[model samples]
Target: MSRNQQIWLGELIRCWKALAPADDNTRKTLAGLVGFAWQPPVDQREPEATPAPEPELPPPVAPSAAPPQPMTQKPKEPPPNPQASELPRVAIEEEAQLQAAEWDSVEVLNPPQPHNRQYNNLLPPLFRPLWSRTIVTTLASRRLPIGFVDAERLVSTMAAARPVERIPRQPRWTTMKGVQLLLDKTPGMAPFLSDQAALAALFDDCVGGEALERLHFFDSPLRGVVIGGKKAAYRPPQPGVPVVAVTDLGLGAPESHFNRAAPGEWLSLVQLLAARDSTLTILLPWPAAAADPGLQRCTAIVEWDRSTSATLVRRLLERICG
Candidate 1:
């Protein structure tokens, strides 16, 4: 049958299985009518036991002359066809090339070694706590260039490495809270919270009268109430007055959340936020695993594993020392 016909027939069988009753006679009759047989499943039956074969007796030993001379290395055998050496050097080279190509095509099951320093150094120490060693090593092997390009590659590699697992919600929340606490502690900084009402009040307090008219909020798929209008037009935050934008793309549940927004939409959202020149603090549940393209646009890509107080303290120490 044609491929399409086969597919249709398979689908029909699946539909039948779903709709049909659990009567064995009905199933057997229907299966026979469809040119198929309903045999009892092999797994349901106990396998037959087989008798073990008897061990074979060793061959009878033959008598040897001179009480068996001391063993010596076997003489090297001559090539089967000495004339084969007369073949063209080009032919020999071609054979060697084919062998090398076969080896190259073989997949290496072992994990790759961590070698690329450029990729490793691209990530900041503060953010290193978020990624596992395996993830880092995988990214480094790709030798991705610095900047958003590396982010794209990292996301793709992460997705390929762990295709089924979704980014956990708790880590994203924890990282968001940690980053917020860190920024809040910093003097003279006004953070843009996810709470729209609170953010509106904060904007009024910070930007005030005339600036507030230029500033407006727009709802975002991944982020809520993105500060747009004239405020978004600014390239960089003014000194001593930093606008911190906080967004948490919480655990992408119900596949539709991501499906509704094309990967490009997420990328554009990130780019737009990045262009605003605000201190953009994004909390995303495992973007790499999701292969979310927006991940590549961010300045920092930190893994938010379940971090302990000791780990946090160690990171802080490293940050201070550096």
Candidate 2:
């Protein structure tokens, strides 16, 4: 309590106060050292805070509140063509040209070969002509039967194959005339005539000189010749041309007048045998049972025109060469 002591005490208290937060002992020392009274803080003061209440919300709306909707839009379509579409002209023309360029021109041939024959038989069996089955032969064993059969079948089938002049009644004496009239009068006859000539030329060409000599002819010098004896006569108006005639069915004689006889019947048997003449006579009709017809009685007088036969042979040769 002296003045010095009090001053010392004041200094110590000041030091203690400075160091008070270091320890509890430092606080007690600071209290003892200080002459004046002082107290340490004991309790912490609480901080004040306030929060506001939330406001009430309205209920959610139903699907009915949404706006009415339209269907989804479709993509736009292209406009329709006013005119119908067609193939291009170039394409059409090209197609037509292709068809024309590829066309085939095959032609048929007749009197088919035996082994390599195109047709099955001489005549179509189901529907056949009367002459298809007929056969004949001359007195010298020359086969007129084959020739007549071929010629008649050729003529008949040709008539049937195409539109031809049809006579209501075909007479025996008038066949060649009928044929001539048809050739002269038919419409579109050019193609048919040309075709026929070409066919005949083909046959002629196939026959060699030796083969031509094989054909049978009756040698005669006259405007025409008689065939089938005294019953019938076929005269080719031109010299050296051949004619055809059939025997009269009613003629009862074994050598019917129509079956044999002719003008200029003086040719040698060899010449007649050679078949070089143009006129040819053949017998056709099967002899009746009571009367048997033989070829020895059948004869022909064929007229000859050297120029015509040569021409026929030459044409035949040309065809054969092809």
Candidate 3:
């Protein structure tokens, strides 16, 4: 198509002719036609350079003084080719570095805090109040850290002789004397029953050595029942133990109470107290008659009769200990 392409093609034809098994004359003719000139047999042929044509001159310069014309020259060429594919290598590296820096500079937003939750709406409003009323307000009312057991002495004695501290007697429900003894012996019974030592310390100031000496369990000889806060006990009293206090402590009582309510109001106040308070002993009204279900609502029932002040104290104690 172009002059260079035609020349290259002619050179290729000359080469092909030399390699062919044609006659020497034919090969010589082909070389001449392709513009390949041969030298004498004794000497090798040398390539000759063709002189370029002179550039055209400008018109005659004026006589007046003027600046000289600048020389016209070809532009400087780049260095020899490396490879086209390698051109983007540097750009790729720079782009990756920029992305990493941008990611590092970005800051993360904090998550939102959760909202406070309330009781289910299906439950009656009375359930919450009853539950709150039953929970223990003092450590003296619980079973753990008995008022009778001296922690320091107990720990020391246990370390000296045995590997574990000896369990001390914790007074539970029994006869009227047992109830009086529990009240008289440990005025801080509500606070002392908690497992937390810090909470028990609150009642430690109220309970004395005298109350500690007389502390005893009902029926069972075992000392000090561990009660409340994660680990707790809901032991039903034995046949011999008298009903000093009554409570709807069993699950069956609450289930029955739940059945009595209307279809929409399924929860029982007594059950709500047991679930939430974990301390108050809920007293259910005795059955109205022989065939009545009220009597079955509670395992034990005790009649409380005292002066206004005494009644208040008894109620307070019941709230704390139950």
Candidate 4:
């Protein structure tokens, strides 16, 4: 073949080797395309056959007459450091001794006396009784305004009002005489009657003039005054009313003495009273406009601001000189 033809054939063989499928039929087709006879390369000569050697057998020995003896046990080795073994024991003993010494050195202290008798004896004879009475009175009068002497009378009025009982609804507006008649029927309304003008002013300041105009008076079964709409209606008690203080508003904190979670109990009894009595008046510290939406349902809300020093002095003088 010419050099150019040889180069062409070389390129063709390489392309066939790269692109063709590697198989016997593919090799035959490649040979036919190249115009060469197809045949597998012949083996030069048969390799000499060699047989594998058999595995060597181990030698057999005769059995011994007696069983083999157990190996002698090795002696237990001692700890690497002898002192380390005793360290823990020594430390424990020292700690115990130190604790014993400390206990022994500690001086016995006498219990303190509950009260110093010498100091107590120095006080005046009337001091103990007066102090005890003051403490008890202060503790017992939770939520009650200080210097309010008419609380009991007010409570009585609330009790006589029978606020929980249903009454005939009246017109929104009524005269002072109508109020007086209602108060007269309820035994404990003397406090409200003491200062009608002041009461009216108080109502005017609390609810707007519209509420004051529509006001109807009712006697509270607990000796207090209940002020609500003339047409307000109360539901009847389930069977009876539980004993409770009329001043209870049922808004006390859970931890307060006035909390009403428990019925017929200290503060809880007040909650029962509020639930059973619809005529109870709640004293709100803020103006009606500032009250929360939940509190808007209240029939009346009274706002009381602290009196100034001048006002207090003037009132006191008027009372004293009068």
lDDT against the true structure, per candidate, is 0.34, 0.30, 0.31, 0.33
Global local distance difference test of model 4: 0.33
Q: Candidate 3: where are CA atoms >4 Å away?
A: 1-144, 150-162, 165-272, 275-300, 303-322
TM-score of each: 0.22, 0.17, 0.17, 0.17
Candidate 3 has a TM-score of 0.17
- Judge candidate 1 at residue 7 and give its lDDT: 49
Instruction: Name the lDDT value of residue 164 in candidate 3.
Output: 61
For model 2, residues 73-106, the per-residue Cα lDDT tens digits are 3234356355524535666544433332211121
| Total clashes for model 1 | 1
Deviation (Å) of 71 in candidate 1? 94
Using lDDT, give the best candidate's number: 1
Task: Count residue pairs with overlapping backbones in model 2.
Answer: 18
What is the C-alpha lDDT profile of model 3 across 1-322, one tens digit per residue?
A: 4465456455644575356524436544544555433221211122323564565777778867555432332235456377845686776544433332222122222222132223333323221233222221221233333346566766776778876636654444322211101111122222222222221221222332222212223211122322332322334232222112221122223333432223111124223334543332222222212212442233122211111122343454454445
Candidate 1 per-residue lDDT, tens place, 1-322, comes to 4464454446436745465634557655554554444432212222334664565876767675334532332345455586765876776644433332222122222222232122223323322433433322221111112223344545766878856344322111011111111111111111222232333333343334333322222223332222432324323333212223322332333434442334564456445544543223332324434445445334233333334233443332223222
lDDT of 4 by residue, 1-322 (tens): 4454455456545755476534547755664555433443222233434664564766665677554542333345455685755666766544433332221222222223332122232323211332432321221111212333454555665779855332223222111211111121222323323333333433333333442332333332223234452334322233222111111222322343332222222223234334654122222223434544443342332332232122332232223223
Q: Cα miss at 39, model 4 (Å)?
A: 99
